[model samples]
Target: MTAGHVPVAVVGGGQAGLSVSWYLGRAGVEHVVLEAQTPVHAWADTRWDNFTLVTPNWHCRLPGYAYDGEDPDGFMTRDEVVQWLAGWLQTFTPPLRNHTRVSTLRPLAAGGFELTLATATGEEVLTCEHAVVATGGYPIPVLPAFAASLDGSITQIHSEQYRNADQLPEGAVLVVGTGQSGAQIAEDLHLEGRQVHLAVGSAPRVARFYRGRDCMTWLADMGLYDKAAPEYPGGKAAIEKTNHYVTGRDGGRDIDLRRFAVEGMRLYGTLSDGKDARLTFEPSLRHALDKADAVYNSILSDIDAFIEREGLGRSVPPATRYSTVWEPDAEVTELDLAAEGITSIVWAIGYRPDYRWIEASAFDGGGRPMQNRGVTEVEGLKFVGLPWMHTWGSGRFLGVDRDARYLADNIIDAHQRKSALESSALRASAHHHLAVAR
Candidate 1:
């Protein structure tokens, strides 16, 4: 079946796609947003019950919908975030097709592209002059090959599947990967007085507050978000680094792994191999902890420099420092899950992009679409919402609007050009016929 055609079609009705739709609407561009589920699906479904934004509420800017809440400094819980997203959707009321999944997309032989959408009723084909893919960067969770070797008695789940400590079976829990989700989930389990074992990765940690200001606010003020990925110290590779672990829960605070260790949470190094109930770990726990602290202090030092350079030493409070409260005396390289009473494992190793449905040559070896600020070499193809698309905030709610606006302008320009060319050809044909009659 054919669902007709459109000038523009946006895939994925998440924040990214909705932002683009808002811009297209403002410009009077006719477009339809195709979403596999509800627009607020991710916030509604994947997140844990207690999940809150690590960034401040003030950063929740989606197009014209800048956060106007009373608590700009506070974080929005999962439900609040969903409401905020839905609120934006209601404001514009853009054309949206819910429960419509774009199963495959390929460039047409001519100027447009063909999309195969799967819905509850049946399959439908739709063609569009331009397609904006805003399906986000991370789509699939990553798990170690050894995860399958674990005993069947233990319940294993990805971080996206984790809800709260009560959801897991009664007993000790082992949380792997110290990225943002891993670290925060470990803390959540620890808070419930569960015997939590954390397998720490090299992911860095950051202070929640600095100089009486939220760390994110200070960083923004310091122009960190304005810096492009390539301009970072490590260049483009820095864009791929795992986000620093911090939390805005309970009115915001630092996620200090060392503090958790001091409080009796068993910390292990990176998990290496697993078989049945036995798991082996590397002896880099101390190094990983130290490296995390070093990065944390380095950020503080940068803030201090920014304060000194701005000559706001008096206005801002004195610089605070983090101290190493606890460290592993020696590496505990192995643990038997059965003996340790480990009943569940939460794998927080992160996610990778899946562009397999998009049969286009715009992808790199790693499956990331190649684009410059969301505009690709493929004429009518574009992308949005990938991390570091142009700046540090590109994929985030902080700067997605800017990227969307740019793409909207590009689409408008293309339409104008096509109309002008067609008008010129029509006039030329008319003149030729008149000359032949004379």
Candidate 2:
């Protein structure tokens, strides 16, 4: 069967895909973006109603689109973010086929790509020289298997499914994972008069306002966000997990587990297991905090080194580390969720991309999409927002655009090269014909 052809087929309509599309459009490339949901569906659908961007407005650097709002330093709320993305779509008017979910993306034996999509109308097939999967930072929410072992009486929700406190049933909330979303949700529930228990791990935190500048500002000044994964003191391992983590509430304040502990929120080590109406936890809270502190200090040290080397001597706030002051092992290990009246469990375990649709040899053994930056093993196949796609900020709002730009440039160069080859071949044929006539 003949498939509709385009130079490029962009899968996913979120910021990543859209950003890539924007670049392609600018370069006059023929491409179609396939969006499963509306643009920015992640923020519009999955995120909580009260969610706000952890990064400040200034850091939301969409290519050719800057945040032109009254508060550059202020964080944008969920709706505002959606609106911005929707507006970006409107401005560029990228060729977006909405409600089109790609069922399969595989390299054809002949050449190029074969795409099968279930769109609003019906099933459709497409062929493109290049394929860009901007599907998501990760495919599905990372949920712990132990969640199912809990008593059926307790309502458990992945951070992705959670809406707001109003929707949750009455009782204490056991928010799992001390990462960004987990910490923010726990703090929100705690401050909103809900007894919150955070299952802490070695998730780091940085003060929103560090020294005389914002944390992001300092990082930017020091080129931390732009640094490639290999440049980190922790090396590529530092970016193996979710590299971005910051709280947006309290007007862009730091919401670490230790701070949550001091503020009356119960902090426990990792939720090791659940069995027979009992929950087991790792006795590593202090170790976790130390690890978290280490990351923060590492970053700050980098900034300090930058300041010293550049001769930009700027006085900064003194370092103030949060002390847990509580023994992790001694803290309540086994807790009966039902007996403790824990009505809700917010699992903020994190996310992993679902590239099952892709049949190309572009993913690694661990299922992570493998590529040299955005360029994959399969020629003309690329990924835009995977963790460490190119840099620490690769999966971030400010970084996706850069990755998109690179992918677009890469595709365009290939196209030009193809065109050049064809032109040279045609010229050779013409000269041969003339020679034969003579």
Candidate 3:
């Protein structure tokens, strides 16, 4: 085991981790980032082949960098994002130790931390005054309970494992959950000549347009794309809260879920009645569309106001009121997967934060780490990248950038103050020992 210690250590090198590292570098702090996999491997390797980011490239940049290329509005393919991150890493030059896995973290007696890390070369122990856990949530693919009951002949794969349409079974595919991933996967599978059945669930309301202009343009104009914490606190929360449910970039504008229904994409309402052998469909997809449209419009209006007040220019168009085409409660019933030949189900349900690795006992009964913004009840321990960590934007890509920066700054301030006190105490103890010896 290596005997050295760093002042600060970061575990996980995803967007959140990288953002924190970038800020730390800018602060001239010596820190090390331990990445279990190559940077952006979660996005690069664990996504569908046809997948593209719903958020435009402009909003994709980590701290200390901006996606300032020719196609700012363009959605980045998984590979493009990986390359972008790699390039950003080169520019920032954060000390990244790749393929290093952190097993556990324990608080030391002298007001610091001891980290147990396992690497390809060997195990190593690292001591640090501060540690940041930036492991982004999307680790395991969640499957419904019914997955285990399926027949052995049936093949099931999550959206994470899905690469191309060829990986699917011969028959129709049942995609569960209608979040961004599920919607995109369903659309891709349908285009690949596979019959697709999508089990609708609680999808957040979304819009096809950004502000009065396209959503992408509005995001850029409002600086939501390049937002930093402490600057636009309200804006950050909005982006983080809503970014996960956004869809419709890769397949184009007309291919949005609402538009796709008009163009012959099968829309089965929520699947119910497990006992019934029959499957039912909603008469219209309007209810879901209406809810989504309203949310989208509200977001645009907010952006428009923010832009106008901030004097950011009219890069975004004014908000337009569009009539919703929703019809009340259409009864769609059970999608019988066993009877149909559909063998795979892709559950693209959104992620929940799992902080099981956080050993501090401050977690609430709900298993959520108890934190107020980045500060926790535990002394010298802090958290970043939590949903609604402070303001609305506290956990978005742009939002977390701010939150992490704030946390890093606070950590430095606290560390400096504590170090001074510790030095004073040591000197006092030495004086007492000398007097006793004399």
Candidate 4:
């Protein structure tokens, strides 16, 4: 095994990790970024081929690597995003160790952390005074046990593995989870001339464009994106929820299960329970549909209120509505995917962060990393690019830059404090030695 040390070790290499590195360079801190794959891991491998950013080009904030192009309002494709990140990495030529997966991160007896990494060459140990867990919010997929209970004939794949409809087996698809991924992937399948069953939960959505302005621009103008975690009333649950459901297909359109339903995609309630070849849904299907409508209405209400406050006289078209439901009061709950001729299942149930590598003190009872906007109780340890770490947009491309800068400054301050104490101790030791000699 090889061993080395750095003042700070960033445990990711996506936009967040690279962002932190940018500020660290300005601060002149000796740091290295450890990545399990190539740079921009998510953009490169996790998303579908036609995926595009929900946020516009102008919102691609990466500190010194801000987006510079003619189409600021345009959305970038997945490949475009990867290329941009690759080019940005060149500016700093960051000390990045690619394909180095961190197996464990524990506090060292001598101070700081011992990061055990598994690399191509062999096992490697990296000692760092300060550790930054910028390893993004979605590396691990959250698959439900029901997926295992499905028939052997059914192919189940998480949203991360889904590329296109043609890539899967021929037949109807059951898309579980109505978050951004589930919604978009369902639409992709439906447009590809395949029957799709989308299981939708209480997910909020907003129009992609209104009043000739992007919804994101309106949100940004209202300073809603700047809201901190404390500003959220329901603590962690509220903070973790993101208000994103827009689409980049069809020249940047709004996507929701309701719209998919109108487009002929069958919608189901949340996946509640399942047995072999059998799926059960919560009887709250109507409630779930109403909840979605309410969330959409709330978004529109906020936008209208903002427009009124700003005295902008642009008239908005009559609000679009789904105004429909399927089996509103059905007594049946169990769904047989095999009987329904469902061939594949796409699990888009969001991500559960894996912090097994980190020590116990670094996390809360709920497995969430215990940190105050990336600065933890562990003196030399910190975090960045986590949802609700500081703001509503934390963990997103536009907001990661701010969080990264904050953590970088925080790490630098810790380094300075350590250096100061060491200098004082050395001086005192020298004086004591001279006095003893005399």
- The top-ranked prediction according to TM-score is 1
For model 2, name the residue pairs that clash: 139-353
lDDT of model 4 at position 398: 78
Query: What digit string (tens of lDDT, one per residue) describes model 3 on residues 1-438?
Result: 886698888888877777878878877778899998877678778888777777666665467677888886667777777778788778867789999988877777787778888899999988888888777634556665555655555666777787988876677777766777777788888788787777665565545554434565555566654544345655645434434355545633523455555554556665433322334444334565656666666776677677779876556455565454433345455456667666665666555566665666667786666676666666656666665666544555547677788778877787678789999999999999999999
Residues 1-438, model 4: lDDT tens digits: 989988899998888888889888888889999999978877878889888888889888787888897788989988889888877877877888899999999998888899999999899998998888878755679888667766888888999999998889998999988778877888888888899987876666667887678888888999878978888657767666645566877569877565566667777777888767889887666677677667666777777788888778556554444444443435346788877889899998888878877874877776788788888888788888887788888888878989998888888787788899999999999999999999
Instruction: Kindly give the stretch of ten consecutive residues in candidate 2 with the minimal lDDT sum.
Output: 320-329
TM-score (C-alpha, index-matched) for candidate 4: 0.92
The candidate that wins on lDDT is 1
User: Which regions of candidate 4 fall more than 4 Å away from where they truly are?
Assistant: 233-237, 314-332, 421-438
Candidate 1 residue pairs that clash: none
Query: Following a full C-alpha superposition, what root-mean-square deviation does model 2 have from the true structure?
Result: 2.3
TM-score for all models, in order of appearance: 0.97, 0.93, 0.80, 0.92
Clashes of 1: 0
Instruction: Give the local distance difference test score of model 2.
Output: 0.80
Compute the lDDT for candidate 3: 0.67
Q: Where is model 2 more than 4 Å wrong at Cα?
A: 310-329, 427-438
Q: RMSD to native for every prediction?
A: 1.3, 2.3, 4.6, 2.6
| lDDT tens digits, residue span 1-438, model 1 | 766899999999988898889988887888999999988698889999889999999999988888899999999999999888878877888899999999999999897899999999999999999999999888999999999989999999999999999999999999999998999899999998999999999899899999989999999998888787778767866677889999989999999998999998999999999999999999999999999999999999999998999999999789889988987889999999999999999999999889899988999888888999898898799999989999998988898888888888999988778889999999999999999999
Per-residue lDDT tens digits of candidate 2, residues 344-426?
A: 78999887767887888877777887777788788778888776778777878879889889888998898889889999999
